[model samples]
Target: MNAFNEISKSTAAFFVQAGASFGVSFLGAIGGIYFLPLDPWQRLFLGMTVLFLVASSFTLAKVIRDQQEASTIRVRLDEARMEKLLAEHNPFSAA
Candidate 1:
């Protein structure tokens, strides 16, 4: 079907884009390391430090996102409880 062909094309395009982005980023990192004036050991240390920082940042972001989601869920639950209480208190309600 035409839709299937379109889906396949889009998937291929996504793969190509991802590959290109990775290649560019890899080259840029290599170039940056090569240009640094630090000794080999220092460069290695710095690279490792940068990687650790990046990993930590990703972890921190996930934690923050999870906390936000939990707070949102709590808020919704509170709102639902309040609504139920209000309905129960309404004198005009046909119990």
Candidate 2:
């Protein structure tokens, strides 16, 4: 386990693949909206909704990661305190 950051980092290839996938999916959604037989107003609305969904998804991901990191830090602190307490005590020693 890494002392600095308990969580492992994603690989560069994973990042590249994720970026490419996001780009392709976003473009595909926009293209689909463009080629739809619906009215221009409807297409525009759908595109705006999709954009909002993407933004919200990113926000949610950030919040979840932050919460996870906070919990991990809390657990690490608790563990350190427990270790210190244990190190200071000995059953064989007279009180």
Candidate 3:
């Protein structure tokens, strides 16, 4: 149950971050189209730049998220190792 809750929370957070990043990128593209006065080639360049930025943002977010999740897993493993060591050290328990 706790694991399910954690999964749901992480999934929700991921979607929220993705949605927000996409929304901002879209708005930025729209704003650029409306506000920038440029030639055809310039507009094309701007469009490509915006696309690259959006893609980069998503990739960066995923990388950071994976790093954080890995860190959490490492911490949990360390905790379990410590617990096992403590158990082994207990004089009252039969080995």
Candidate 4:
């Protein structure tokens, strides 16, 4: 039910490895495009396309994360309301 419980902490080494992998992949793509014997206009278009893809990927990740957070919050709210109702109930009361 806690935010901390939902997220596991990453070790420094793991964090570094992830970052390095991403950097290598992105740079490799760009470097490969740069070395190709194509016209400048073609290279520029490829570079722009790659950048746009990266941007869209980031945006998509953010959207997914936000949706997950929203769902978790909604579940927590519903749980709280149920708990409050349970706490206020009197089983022996006569109506």
**What TM-score, over all chains together, does every model reach?**
0.62, 0.88, 0.71, 0.87
What is each predicted model's overall lDDT from 0 to 1?
0.77, 0.93, 0.81, 0.91
Best-performing candidate as measured by lDDT: 2
lDDT of 4 at 59: 97
Question: lDDT per residue, candidate 2, 1-95, as tens digits?
Answer: 77646345888899999999999999999999999999989999999999999999999999999998898889989999999999999999998
Q: For candidate 3, give the lDDT of residue 17.
A: 94
TM-score of 1: 0.62
| Per-residue lDDT of model 1, residues 12-87, tens digit only | 6888998798678766776797789989998898788767766797799799978976886799789989999988
Better of 1 and 2 by TM-score: 2
Between prediction 1 and prediction 4, which has the larger lDDT?
4
User: Candidates sorted by TM-score, descending order?
Assistant: 2, 4, 3, 1
The CA-based lDDT of model 1 is what? 0.77
Candidate 3 wrongly placed segments (more than 4 Å) = 3-21, 92-95
**Pick by TM-score: which candidate is best?**
2
lDDT comparing candidate 3 with the true structure: 0.81
RMSD, one per candidate, in order:
8.3, 1.9, 3.8, 2.1
lDDT of 3 by residue, 23-94 (tens): 886997768775788887888888888878878977998999889878888998899899999887978877
Ranking of all candidate structures by their lDDT, best first: 2, 4, 3, 1
